[model samples]
Each structure stands twice: as C-alpha cells, then as structure tokens.
Target: MLMLLWNVLKKFDLLSLDNEEEIISHLRRLSDDENYLLRDIIQAYQILQDCFQNITYQHLQLVKTVVEYSNVIEMMKKSDLYSTYGRRRFQELRDNLTTQFQLQE
Candidate 1:
C-alpha cells in the first residue's frame, strides 16, 4: 500500500524519483506484515512531506533519519538481546537523537 502510494506520488511528480527506490527498499520488508505500524510510518512520511514541502535540505534529512532508525529498529527486533531492558533504553536514546536532528531543521 505504501509502495503504491509512493509510486503514485512519484509518477505524478509529487515525490522525488531519486529517492523512490530507496523508499521502496526501506518499505519492502514490511510489505507483508499484517500490522498497522508500517502504515503509520508511511503516514508519518507523508506528513513530513506535506509539512516540510519546499525544504529539500530538511526533507532529505528526514528521509535519512526515518530509514536509518527503521533499520536499527528492525535489527534490534530480530536480535537475541532485543528483549532486554537495556536495548529498549538504547532505542529510546536513539529515537531522541533522531528527534533532535529533525527538530534542528
């Protein structure tokens, strides 16, 4: 669903073609997940796209932030130590840092 929306947006020049593959790649793994989280992430992406339109500098940074954080989260979830409280704390810190970067622009 997210990929289709992204492709539609890209085809219509509403989104960048350069980042289209990267966005789809980032989203491909969760394509089959029967959960709402992926949809929420795409919604967040769209929100950022709308809210930060015309701010290319910040927009790229936003995409990078989300992709990197999502990758980390995915790795943590698949790792043996993911259930540990310390990993959760680390994720919280990482999220805070990402938020700080987003807030800066």
Candidate 2:
C-alpha cells in the first residue's frame, strides 16, 4: 500500500503540485468519516496524488501529507496492515508515509 502510494506520488509529481487545500480538505473528510474503509484510504491517497501534480507550496503539501498519512495509519490500525504484507512492508509503508508527510514541512 505504501509503495503503491509512493509510486503514485512520484509518477504524479505530487510533491510540487498545487491544490494542497483541496487535497487536505478531502483527507479531512475521509479521516473524519466513522466508517472509513481501506478503499476510502486508497481513494484519498489517489486524490492526494492527483493534487501533487499541481505546483503547490511545500508547506501546504506537507500539511496535507501529514493528515493523509495520519489517515493511513488510522486505517491500518482498523484494517490491520499485518494482513497486507507482513511486518516489513508495514514498516516500509509507515516510514514512507512519514517521509511524505514530513516532506511537506
């Protein structure tokens, strides 16, 4: 899941993209939802990836990434990343999510 998200981010150049606010807003909406499923997490990740294609400020992007990453973590807790790819993938995914979130700052 993390690798997929990272690839999408890299392929889409979401780091320098604009629409940070929109991405953040969408993330907030997803995160706030009580029934957030893995599918929603994937979709939110895609929306964020799409936003990164635009030329946005690094700070805003970081902020958005943090929220999105938080949602990923939360969802992982609910859905169990353990079943996804064992501990190694989970760690890598967590690290990547943190890296992307921090890159915004």
Candidate 3:
C-alpha cells in the first residue's frame, strides 16, 4: 500500500492542473481505500487550493512547513499509538481538514 502511494505521489503533478474537476477525477482514480493515507493528502491539497487561491510565493520555509506537517499527519493517520484522548484529537484534526472547524464543536 505504501509503495502504491509512493508511486502515485512520484507522478502526482496536481499543481499543474487548471481545474478542480480534473483534480477530483485524479483523486477518485487513486484508490478505493476510505481512510487510507491519501485522505490526508486529498484534504490537504483541497484546503490549500481553497485557502491559498491567489497567493504566489516561492518561499522555502513555507514549503518546508507544508511538507513536514503533511508527513507528520500522514504518519499519525497510520499510527496505532493514539489513546482515547489522542484519538479524539486526531479526529478533530481530521474534521478540521474537511470542515475547517466551522462545523466542529
């Protein structure tokens, strides 16, 4: 599964896409796993697309922050060490990814 993900990411040139529909189509073809590692990547890409709609920057620190944050979140998604509280926090983060905390309590 991890290998499949790596292969997809190696060829995933989402930034060059000109339309959201094309991106969604590509994501749909990625994999059928519901909560796989791709979920975090999918949501992160969408949120970044929406939030940074007009920003154009070639900053190194920001790029590092995005990559590091995504890597840690992806690891957390597959980690089994989350206790009850930790699981809840993880869920909250997941929810925020899609809803941006607007619909979360």
Residues 1-105 of candidate 2 have per-residue lDDT tens digits of: 444444444444564446656655656666567688888888776776555545558855664575567767677677666775556777897899999999999
| Cα deviation of 30, candidate 3, in Å | 28
Q: CA lDDT, every prediction?
A: 0.59, 0.63, 0.54
**Considering lDDT, which of the candidate structures 1 and 3 is the better prediction for this target?**
1
Off by over 4 Å in 3: 1-14, 18-53, 56-63, 80-86, 89-105
Tens digit of per-residue lDDT, candidate 3, span 1-105 = 433333333333334446655544555544444564766677646744553465556543454455547767567767743778778877877887879666674
Candidate 1, 5-104: lDDT as tens digits: 4443443445456675655555454454556486767864774366347657775566546554766756767664456776878788889999999999
In candidate 3 the C-alpha lDDT for residue 78 amounts to 71
Q: Give the local distance difference test score of model 3.
A: 0.54
Cα deviation of 40, candidate 3, in Å: 34
TM-scores for all candidates: the values are 0.27, 0.27, 0.23
TM-score for candidate 3, residues paired by index:
0.23
Give the C-alpha lDDT of model 1: 0.59
